[model samples]
Target: MSGLKRLLKKGLGLGDMAFSAGGGAINWFPGHMAAATRAIRNRLKLSDLVLEVRDARIPLSSANSDLQPLLSAKRRVVALNKKDLANPNIMHKWSGYFERCKQDCIAINAHSKGSVKKLLELVEFKLKEVICREPTLLVMVVGVPNVGKSALINSIHQIAQSQFPVQEKMKRAAVGPLPGVTQDISGFKIAQKPSIYVLDTPGVLVPSISDIETGLKLALAGSVKDSVVGEERIAQYLLAVLDTRGTPLHWKHLNNRRAEGVEYDVEENHIYNLKNLKPKRRNNPSNRCDLVYVEDLVMEVQWALHSTLTEFNGNVEDESDLESLIDLQFGALQKALKIPHKASEARLMVSKKFLTLFRTGKLGPFILDDVPDHTPVS
Candidate 1:
């Protein structure tokens, strides 16, 4: 058996896994991202208000630290987008946490009409004083990639148009699932009555990602491309996170028919019976349970890879053979994952499905960030 197979078979403890939180850093700073940063700095002077969007599921990690200085000079509003995908209780705590910091924050589901109404009300309340001084308020929308910046803008425009039928119809900003879709910074006029304008900027990341787990969370949320971080690696991190939280993988939630033949039955409520596993001691064990059994993860990966290979007329006997075949057919596996083949591909198709399930909210609502009880911000 290969080294990985042996390790998997031995059931290496979660802490022993190579992709632990303290594991090697995961960094991605493309030239385009650097250029976007410079562009944001130059354009900050044109706006009076800054709307910073962040993924509600991973609020702290999704907030880019690089833009803090630029945003600090202006009236700022933090919109935690995609609240539907996050835990409501935790989100409530996040709102209070931000409030304690004296920040104007609102949780919103960009697709919801009611939520968008609350967002507009909050924006108006925050800028009421400034709007009185300057009739036209330039609000700049900024965030990391795929945080729903464009969607938020479109929602605001729709609300403004419905409120004022005589105003000129505004063009919709382009949107896509993948990160870095908005490549340029462009301004759109939202409200004609108040003459409110919004500048939509490309999603930008800091030049360096100091936290490995934060980067992984960003990748899992689809803020960064899978190519920057191997699919298998991301899957491993997902497994670890779910395992830590004692959350079931819920394979049935995955729409892929290819996973039917796996050892896990589609009708089962949870993927693995991890209750029998030994619990890891932690300073705060209130949230997490025992670490996930390595064997379960290995089995899931093997079954997924085998099923994918079968589609391509390829076969493997066990985890050891599966690794060898993955090495030879890495490009084919990448195609199965719908990503471009790279020289160092992890070639685990199951990882893509696992991430897709989480991103699509099929696995269930999760608050990836840890939130403890705290006094409400006065």
Candidate 2:
């Protein structure tokens, strides 16, 4: 493992990092997924075009290879969703790369009205070359879980309604941050001159992921649930990626009540420990001293919630009650650390916060796939 880390550090210019996972392929095929595959195959005959949505950050990993055989003969357009969160330079290169392979690819922000309108225009223009007699085109939108499929549908509907006020607006598809929210396949007709109908299918993943890193990337992107791959493990991978990319680890957010300088280092296990840290009292009238360990803060929050639930006979039904309990624990932690932070700002787990920063594009855009050594980048 040490040798591998050295090689990565020297050859790829990545930092010292090593990944450890138990021997076995990552499999995430639920029963509904098989059913979705069968349904998609059955519906392919009725569809004029297939729009495969992919995450721009991890395009190759996010793509479902199982659909290759099924979609080989179908007219397809690869819509790289979440363009806003991806590196624009890499995205432009990917567009040229896809064109060279004779595939129609478009990078689009799923939530943008202009992008959705451009996507609709591409679909209509592509359909014109293939279909001359058919007045209505049935397009099937498919992709792995949480790739913004539902959001794209809603965006299209929204733009269509605004442009053609007389046309009836369709119901918006349910959108959620988590995976597997869209359970069934449904269809909606766009109010356009030619009238295009789009089918929204549930996010389906391949039966088995041969590469563990790909699975990890999917999990980090929230396509796979944290329960499946474990949140802490994902955070470790995130840390490695950030370190390799030369991004600064902003630990100031973790510091709360200490007036003294705080220092930490990332070890092999990615555990952070404070070094040369000293506590000082603030000049406030209360004369309070602050310094708290992160591990202790997490434990206190958990214990407080557990005790509250136990005392209440596990009948805490009000959302505000839960929020209050969390705030109380966070407030205690803030006071101990002397860091001025709102109770509501306290994150339950550091791992979750780390993943959130990456998902929100706070850490910056990343392309996980290894670009070929021979491939040219303009």
Candidate 3:
């Protein structure tokens, strides 16, 4: 009965609607957002205003700059969605950030029709003069997948109807993950008269990288998943990092192979004994602890390369010494992990360049091979 009421209210545009509701705690931007972006670009020339929605919690991380091209000629209204769930102080800072960027910013919960109307009013105010000479006006709504385009549509329709009922409120929701080929893209329209067209798009799901600890760090962080990097690999990586760090505890506790009366403490003798320790058992498939550690370190080296390249500027005084820098940070892993210097070294160089392209958005969809479609849970 409640669900039916929601459907009816949604049809009539009478009450609150669910916009883009993300299904998982960990969210990632996938094919849906990419498709929506393309659709938005195709329609930009036909529109006068672009309404961008973003999550307030991680405002900077959530905004997609890929739409800048479509928005270059179009006026923009930024609606910070889900403000109710974010820190108020953070929202204020973000609002200022958007305003500084010259974007008309409005912090509002997508479920509130009053707020939505206020947003529309702001959009109108920004474009009223521009559209005065035109017959129709176009307003493009953009956001990540599951941000709330569907609910906003219902809210706008309900407000237009001007009929508020006393019955239990209906809950509106997003229609699908991606925009369909149907006339309505998400929930937006293209108008012809001094009219307004709203474009419905998928909510952007930003990729999450919180779960990407290398095997060595994963053992310390305890987030090693057997599916990706098994327990054995993780254990091995921990031993390796500790080895390089001159820590003896990791080697001492290898598969219950503790020295007859030794402890996992930081003493000089322990360190000395650790240097002499070797895998007691040979080639046991069940005890693949060492491999895991090496893999984790290699992942770290890859990230180090990626980050360094990302932070690089035009030129440095000793720019040619970067290869040595790379070796210094990851040389031990290369030696211990038995990863050929060439294979891993090449990836680092490639990843560094890749990150540079990624940050500038020049390498669109290229990093997709490794990055997941959705953000991972922290």
Candidate 4:
């Protein structure tokens, strides 16, 4: 462990100031992350209110635990983004959930002004305590990477008509806390009447891997591949729910396929119809369809898995194809297989690489469509 520490130190060449500033002797802090933490702390001093942005779907997961303590003295406003993508009823429930914590909660679509208006209102309300002392409002915006934090800032400023012009205009661009910047701090000025200043911080995350898990669960519940755990688990869980809901195929289509002999028009009946027509047990749609939207889901998952595998760049690329197995039509199959309730593991199984690969843009945004998984196995 000490060797790892020394190697890290030598590798990063942390300036003597970092070691002396009582930042605490961190034995294993990744260089980029350590700088980001320092940047966050420094930025906290220049701001009065903290605007924490989180994915509306997974608000808790997206909260920046690393910056939590730093925000102890400041007013905190939690902004939930991508409300349009979340389950609406759940979104309301979550808003109430955060209100109980003394946190100002607002749901917004980062891409639209309507979604953020409520957020601006909440920020002004939270800043009431310090608004009197400084005519210029200093609210710091923070969130984890790729959670649309940057987009949120851009959208807010655009709508406000330069009321919250970026810190660059205030000559405090050097004061903001993001690690990549060489300047000290960034500040903003409000352009219009409901005056407020805004500072944007790069997304931050907790030190532990479990933090990422929590964050992933909230943001990826609907969009993930399947319910394995965390993002994937929730994704799988949604798939199971969609299964019960009889999704993908409208009821009309289901009936039409059953009435007619069109294989694609029907739902799960393709398996049975194909079997009935064969001299041997074969797949050919004759006239009846048995399954519902769940079959199409299976095909989608199968296609996603295949595309993920074929695109893998690691040793997995040279590995033999995964043998066709039973369909994982329910989210429970992930648990039954004893796979970790983790999106990372499922990602590796599907894409054959570490989870970071997916984050770093090495693998996906996998494409999936209504395609059958089996074709006579020939």
Q: Taking the tens digit of each residue's C-alpha lDDT, what string does model 3 give over 190-278? A: 23345566666554433332322221132222211222333333333332232222323222233232235333223322111211212
| Model 4 lDDT tens row, 171-230 | 222212122332123445554443567776644445543322232243332222122223
Better of 1 and 3 by TM-score: 1
Residue 113 displacement (Å), model 3:
1.8
Ranking by lDDT: 1, 2, 4, 3
Checking candidate 1 for backbone clashes, the offending pairs are none
Each model's RMSD to truth, in Å?
13.0, 14.8, 20.6, 17.0
lDDT of 1 by residue, 59-128 (tens): 8899888778678667899999999899886788898888777888999999888998998788888888
Q: Tell me the whole-model lDDT of each prediction, alpha carbons only.
A: 0.68, 0.66, 0.45, 0.46
| TM-score list, all predictions | 0.68, 0.68, 0.43, 0.51
Top-lDDT structure, candidate number: 1
Model 3: lDDT to the true structure: 0.45
Model 2 TM-score (2 dp):
0.68
Q: Where is model 1 poorest over a 10-residue stretch in terms of lDDT?
A: 286-295
Q: Tens-digit lDDT track for model 2 on 197-274?
A: 889999999887756577778988989888777665676555445433323323334334233444443232323322
Model 3's TM-score against the true structure: 0.43
Angstrom error of the Cα, residue 367, model 3: value is 27
Supply the global lDDT for candidate 4.
0.46
